[model samples]
Target: MVINLAMKILIGIPFVFGLLVYKLRTRHLSTFNAIENFLRSQNNLMPISYSYSDIKKMTKGFREKLGEGGYGSVYKGKLRSGRDVAVKILGKNKSNGQDFINEVTTTGRIHHVNIVRLVGYCADMSHCALVYDFMPNGSLEKYLCCKKSGIHSLTWEKKQAITLGVAQGIEYLHRGCDMRILHFDIKPHNILLDDNFTPKISDFGLAKSYSNETSIVTITAARGTIGYVAPELINRGIGAVSYKADVYSFGMLLMEMLSLKKNLIQNTELSSQYFPDWIYDHFNKSKDLEIGDAEELGCEERKITRKMTIVALWCIQMNPVDRPSMSKVMEEKFREKFNLVRGGFYTDEVQGS
Candidate 1:
């Protein structure tokens, strides 16, 4: 009888522990869900929350994929209102949820022509996604870098307009906002164009925000694409970290637009060669900016190209302090004065000596 009692107790002990474990797990999950709900409700201007089911319905079962990146895949979807939207379904493998939060918070309050509009987002457990206004013309890279057939179709005027639009957008982020927002990733791929070719800045996954009083922000890790990342970001010893990093990125992008070539060609023997050096040399030698179909370019086109080139050079200065503030770059007087045709001595104006 004692032996039988011992066997029964052993079986009961295993069952009891299993029951406790299951209950504990259930309670923890409930607490987690409650906290998440509270946080979601706290965002005053938060974007509309969509459920996982809603995302699936809106996306029509991921029917059309727009593109894919390190973040995740983007699919073309339609809202119930019959409006089109681009749904970015974040990858499940992302270790941290910071990028998802960053994009939503950074873009939610911003309302500008040059900035991409964040329609809404989904944070249903492990399934996360972001919805944006569908860009009809797609990314600027498709026009400038790829689709060689359409390169010439983007006239110098359109290119200049796109560059100006991007600058204005960055300027808004830097000064127009309640806090300064630094776009760590600024490249051709991030600039989207509408049906009318209006450029809007997108992809704020790597962006950072700081108060006006803050001069230098501590960077935990290097941010931005390789070719476009500022020298200061790669090596803090080079210069202080500030909005100037974005300026460097914009400069690299501007150079790419002018040169009509990829800034960094991978796995090539000439990878060591930097294109900015060629830009300076070309300027000094009075060589034509190797804009494709240069013979077809009119006088105004040349003027715009020269002005953009000069501004780009100033932005990419080795020292962060040397770069002009975005506000200064957008000033009317500065724009008018710099637009004048100088005899291949545009550097003098850029140097401001």
Candidate 2:
């Protein structure tokens, strides 16, 4: 029996290794051809293709690094047309090319003023990269966590406008697109600001899309940053994950816009009250707000600020059912109840698809 077991183990080892090698080889080949496959297929819009060598030339040998993520690093690059672009070069991961495929296909189909523009992509052999219009102001995160004296604090007007753009962008994903998309990851770091301080949603690596047939989806695993993940994603008992999950994440992001920068549960001495509860209580009672720099805002600006604050608190409600959907911004009930700005907070708005 021991001899038979040893013989079986030896045979199974080769079989397992061969199977892994086959899968890897298949993935490697598919990744090498993903761009071509995407090009031949039908899409709402067709972003051009770029060669790997072209990426190197544009990125100047990856000299100016802008940011890094679990999958890869982003570099500052300039296109031949003299346009500045941010290039994302995918890194090694066992997901093979699944993430690169998702990022390319997802961003390629959608276009909204608040959504980042996908200019082109590179998928030469195992090397893959995505090119996007460069955001001059970088991410909303730097401002949220900034302590540098040189970093000019964003005015109340700018803060509200930026968050409003982000909200609209997320709403577009949920309702405006041909396919309903849930941005499983929505955090300050994923929100980019252009020269005008208009926020554009970025980082589609974790995006999940559903057909117009259904708003609810059952993902195999929870997806989002630690602080921004909805309670439903973490505990099934809370609710089924759906578009509301994205709403919950946006709530967390908006809550931080009020200057609750750190996770209060982990960082604050106000153990008696949940952070959102504190904001809710203060805003309702008209108590003096210690939020960021709100005390200095003028009366009109403060009214707008407090109104948005209420919306933010409403977003972070513990139950997914209680939270408002992103598209609810369109409804009169949402408009009157949340008092979300009459028009968008920004002026001279232009949308590019």
Candidate 3:
């Protein structure tokens, strides 16, 4: 009996030691894998891999200015293949390295027809820039708000198509990826228009990704442009943050598209009383609104456009839950048309689709 008991103890000790060794090895492998993924993600984040010198040669010392935004100045360039590109140079010694990393990490991996493509990047000290496929038409904001271009390039059908494309791009960002990507910024300016007039969603620097269980990401300070920011985000200091903030911004963008007006009216009775708050309140009081530049649209087109305005209002509802999902937005745009009309005019300003 004593010999058998001693044998059992010796075998059990070896078994326990072996289990510990296996566990340690597994953990070490996991850590190594994470490190590997981070490095690999960084290495391949930007699609274009040109050396800084090659980029300078293409831009000709940043000769042709394309545009400027909150990030930096953009210059036009043509690659060896004769493909035009937009080169965005970040400010020298800029403090927003994290934003740069986010742009590279997220935008680099995303490839879709409606989303802007990141052709390359330059991350050397004293200089940081991102290269993207040059969008010839500039942004939707320019056509809608800027008057410099005397003629109206965007027709009624074009507006509908642009709206559809933008929605599709946002839907792709939210649900098309392996992870859920929240575009913390979704204003008109972030939406670029291609030569073909397709709306391509751009600027991933302010975006955030979350897992299924994460309801919110901790933010040290408020992010996103004002007027376009969601109410919850504006009030983020008082409560936790969530992805729904994005939905709210989308709502604002929708309203902007509907009205063809910037939502930044300050100290006006209209903004405090009617702009956002009135959208839903007016909807409740009356199911739709007749909005848009009436001078540009025909009576029949104006009626159809009103239906779209109603849909936009639906998207911009104060409650995130009230806003439809991106999939639903697509369905609303394509699946059906509203017949709510008065004498060949849809009671609403535009059709939802």
Root-mean-square deviation of each candidate, in angstroms?
A: 6.6, 6.6, 13.8
Tens digit per residue, CA lDDT, model 3, 113-179? 9989999877554456789999999888877774423574467678788878888888887778877
Model 1 TM-score (2 dp): 0.81
Which candidate model has the greater lDDT, 2 or 3?
A: 2
The whole-model lDDT of each prediction reads 0.78, 0.77, 0.70
Using Cα atoms with residue i matched to residue i, what is each candidate's TM-score against the true structure? 0.81, 0.81, 0.76
The best-first sequence of candidates by TM-score reads: 2, 1, 3
Model 3 score (lDDT): 0.70
Once fitted onto the true fold, the runs of candidate 1 whose alpha carbons sit more than 4 angstroms away are: 1-38, 147-152, 260-271, 277-289, 332-353
Clash pairs (backbone) in predicted model 2: none
In model 1, state the lDDT of residue 68. Answer: 99
lDDT of 3 at 199: 87
lDDT of 2 by residue, 1-353 (tens): 99999999999999999999999888778665664676567566567789999999999999999989797899999998999999998885725566777787678887889999999988777688899999999999888787524465677678878878888899899889888888899999999999999999998888888897896797988888987898889889988788888887888887787765353344557656655555555456655445555556689777766666666666777677767777664342223353323222111211110
